[model samples]
Target: MWYQVFLWALFSSMFVHIIAALIAFCRLRKHKIGAAVAGLYRAADFEMMPFYALVWGVGQSIIVSFVSFTRILATL
Candidate 1:
């Protein structure tokens, strides 16, 4: 249960970060990023670490799968 709670908090933070990034990316056009906006961008960038861990920890296979999927979907 302890580990479960920990994972829950961890995943929550990760999800929040992803949501924040989407918001920042969406807002980047209209607003100039001052200190606070910069802070939000920085936070979204920092979220990559936890996001990577959460996703990669699921499995290497999934990571590879996703890379391919993203390339195909985004055509990037």
Candidate 2:
């Protein structure tokens, strides 16, 4: 059933996008990694810290929110 679930178009697309974004966010940061990677801009300078804003303190929340919405719509 889990394998069958992975085959759906919606799941595949959203998962691909999520994975890509996560990779990108990781590449952009050096000191810490968290939900905020989504929001990082070129202007930002690296400042190593122990923690980050939770639940997408970075720009990632927007992408995650969109993906979540799509999942909800697909279930309907």
Best by TM-score: 1
- Tens-place lDDT digits, model 1, residues 26-70: 777667555576688687886556877777678888877988877
lDDT for residue 22 in candidate 2, whole number 0-100: 97
lDDT string for model 2 (1-76, tens) is 8777767977889999999999887766653643365346423765545365454365597887887978976777
The worst-scoring run of ten residues by lDDT in candidate 1 lies at 29-38
How much does candidate 2 score in TM-score? 0.31
lDDT top scorer: 1
Per-model lDDT = 0.80, 0.68
User: Any idea what lDDT model 2 has?
Assistant: 0.68
State every prediction's TM-score relative to the real structure.
0.39, 0.31
Question: Each candidate's root-mean-square deviation in Å?
Answer: 14.3, 10.1
**Global CA lDDT of candidate 1, please?**
0.80
